[model samples]
Target: MKIGDLSLPEILKKTTATQGLCFDVGAFSIRLRSTHKNFIHTFHKLYRDFPVITDDQLIDFHIDMVIANNYRRWIKPQIIARIDGQQPFQAFAATHAMPLFEWALNWSIARLGQHYLMLHAAVLERHGKALILPALPGSGKSTLSAALAQRGWRFLSDEFCLVQPIHGQIVPIPRPTPLKNESIAVIRNFDARVFIGPLFEKTRKGTLGHLRAPTASVDCLKQTAAPAWIVFPQYQNQAEVLLEPLSKSAAFLKLASNSFNYTLLGATSFNLVKTIITNCDCYNLSYSNLDDVIAQLDVLSDNAQ
Candidate 1:
C-alpha cells in the first residue's frame, strides 16, 4: 500500500505517536513518529508515492518528531527530532518540522549508510545510465537536478549519490528535493507541473521549500543505474551554457572531496571512485538558462547512446 491510499485520520491511526509510520524509500525503510499536524499533512502529500511498509518489516531508521515537553512547548513551540532514541540536533520551531525531518533523514543516511560510497551530489538516470552532478552548496546542483527530473530524466536523489562499491552502480533514493531561497521561485517558473511544498521562512538555510519527487521516479525506486557521466554544475546569472571536458584524474580528486565517507571507507572507496572516473565521461558545466542546459544534456545523452 502507498501513503496516498490512507486518509489523514487513517494515517494518524496507523502512525501512532508510539509505533510510528513505516515506509520504504528505495533500499531504506524508515519509521517516522510525529504528532505535528502540519508536518504529517505535508509529509503525506510529499511522500504519497512511497510504499507503506508494515511494522513487521525491518526498519533501518526510527525517527521521532515530538513537541518539546518544556515551557517552550507552549511559548514558542519547538519540535525535537530523535533518531534511534538519540537526539542529534537542537530543537527547531514547530513550523520547521518538515525541514527537520528531511535534514534528519539525510544525517541518518550519511552516517549509517557506509556500505555505499556516498557523495554530495544530485543523481539522475536516463536510458539506464546515471548522470551525477557533484558540487558544493549554491552551485545549482538541486535546481539543475530538479529541472532535469522534470524534463525527462528519472530522479535518483538530490542530496546523495550512493555508489555500490562492488558493482559500481548508483542506487536510487528518490526524495523531495529541497529548494532554497530563490530556487523556490526559479523552479516554480521553470515548470508549471512541479509541486512545491509550503515556504519555510527564516531557517538556517534561509527560506526553504521542497520540490516533490516526480511520480515516475518514485515508482522506480528499486532500479539502479550505472554511472555514465559526471558533470560539475554551477549556475551563473546570464552566463552562456558551457560544458567543458574534465580529466579523469581531476574528476577523481573533486569527487573524492565531495564524498561523505571517503576517508572512512579507505581503499574500497578509492577503487570505486577510480572505477567511476575511468568509465564515465566527465565535464564541467556552467549555465544561466535551464532550458539550454537541458537541451545540451539531452544532446549529450543521445550522442553517447
Candidate 2:
C-alpha cells in the first residue's frame, strides 16, 4: 500500500475532545484518538486508523495487530502482533515493528536502494561521533541510552540503529524505548520525568509500554555520527562495572550477527564494517549500576577527544 496516500480511519470515543493524534509510522500516518477511559482502546484505535500496509512491490511484508475482548488475544498471524494484558506495546513492537517500519519506508522512498541495513542497536551521539551499542537483549542498552538522552547525548534510537553503508556512518532515527518489567520501574526511579504509557497484560513478552525518546534527538537526523566506539553492554544480576576491550574480529562478528540485512548487503556491508571496526574502538562493558556506567562512559568519551 502507498502509506503516504493512505488516510486514517475515523475514531469513535465519548470522552475524547479530538478525533486523534496523527503519527508518522514510516510512510503511514497513524491517527490515534485517546479515550482516556481505556488507554489500550486508544492505542488500538490509533493502530487501525491508517490503511493496512499490504504486501506489494514496495512493501516486502505486512504487519497488523489484533486485540480480542480486551482480555485475550484470540488470534494473531505471524505478521500480526497480539499485545494483550496491561503491558506496553512499545517494547513488544520494537523488536518487530521498529525495524520493519524502517525497511518498508526506506524501500518505498528508495532512499538507499536495497543496500541499507538496519540493526536492533541503541545509538547515542556525543560531540559529533556516534556510540553504537550492539549488545544482546538482556543488556541495559535501552536504559543507558535513555539516561544519556535525558542528559546530553542525542538519542538516535533506543532499540534500533540504522547504518549507512557507502558513507560508513550511523544515522539517527529517534523513537521511544520500550522498558519491560523491572526496567520500567528502574528508569522511573532514576527520573520521574520519563513518559511511560499504559501496559498490556499476559502477552508473550510480559506487560509492556514505552518511554518516549527526546524530541531534540530526532531533530539531528541529518548529522552523521562517526562510529567512534562500539560497546557491547551486559547487565548482570549484581556485577561490578567492567569495560574490557574485545578483539576487533570478535566485535565484527557480533555486530554482523546483530545487523538486520548484513548478508543481503554483501560487499558494501563488509567494507562499511571493516572501515568502522578498524578505525573505531571496541569494548565489553558490564554493569549493574547506571551511575557507575554513565560516569565511566564520560571518562571514555573525554579520552576520545
> What TM-score, over all chains together, does every model reach?
0.99, 0.69
- Cα lDDT of model 2 by residue, 94-194, tens digit: 22433223333334323233445666689888887788898777678887888877777877776557777767677665645767677878888888876
lDDT of 1 at 50: 96
Worst 10 residues of 1 by lDDT: 11-20
TM-score of 2: 0.69
User: Can you write out model 1's per-residue Cα lDDT over 1-305, one digit (the tens) per residue?
Assistant: 99988999888876665777999999689999877888999999999999998888899999998898989886899999999999999999999999999999999998899999999999999987899999999999999999999999999999999998879989899999999999999999998899998899999899999899999999999999999999999999999999999999999999999999999999999999999999999999999999999999999999988
lDDT of candidate model 2 versus the reference: 0.60
**Local distance difference test scores for all models:** 0.93, 0.60
What are the candidates' C-alpha RMSDs? Answer: 0.8, 8.2
Model 1 lDDT at residue 77: 95
Best by TM-score: 1
Where is model 1 more than 4 Å wrong at Cα?
none
lDDT of 2 at 195: 71
Overlapping backbone residue pairs in candidate 2 total 13
